[model samples]
Target: MLKFIKGNLESIDGVAVYPIISLLIFFIFFAALFWWVFTAKKDHIKEVSNIPLELSENETNDKNDLPL
Candidate 1:
């Protein structure tokens, strides 16, 4: 099965660049995610952590407000 798939892929023109492009996209996505997680503010994290509890306050104050 693996050999069959490889044979099919190798026959296609410009197929080699697909793997390189996909790997670059995957690496960039994770790199950006890591950067965001490390650089995020503690205050923003704290506020986000309390999101569930904040929902109740909104429920009592403005029932008509959007859920999020």
Candidate 2:
């Protein structure tokens, strides 16, 4: 496995740089997403969080209750 990786690395130009660049891009994307989620307006986050509960409650109310 080590030999295969070394051979492939030698065959590709700037392959080592690609991984570092990709990692940096991924980190930046997640950092921005985290900042947005945490720093966004309170009302916006509240609205988003309520969506699931609202849908589930509506569905549950529509279903007929079972007898004990």
Candidate 3:
């Protein structure tokens, strides 16, 4: 399977550019994610981190009732 793909790509002109572009896209995505993590407000991060806890608390409290 690997050889088949390599053979097909080798026959295409400028196939190398595809990998470069993909790498650039992947790098940019992670870079943006890292920047967001660093720049996000402390309160926002704390709220997001407690999402699972909040859901569990609500479920426990609402177990005997139905939400509208």
Q: Per-candidate TM vs. native?
A: 0.72, 0.68, 0.72
* Rank ordering of all candidates by TM-score, starting from the highest: 3, 1, 2
RMSD each, Å = 5.9, 2.7, 4.7
Model 1 stretches with alpha carbons more than 4 Å out? 55-68
Model 3 steric clash pairs: none
lDDT of 2 by residue, 1-68 (tens): 99998997899877789889999999999999999988899999899899876757657766747554
Put down candidate 3 lDDT per residue, 1-68, tens digits, no spaces. 99999999899999999889999999999999999989999999899899876657667778858766
State the weakest 10-residue window (summed lDDT) of model 1: 52-61
Better of 2 and 3 by lDDT: 3
lDDT of 1 by residue, 1-68 (tens): 99999999988999889889999999999999999999999999999999877667656778776486
Q: Model-by-model lDDT, in order? A: 0.90, 0.85, 0.90
Model 2 compared with the native: what TM-score? 0.68
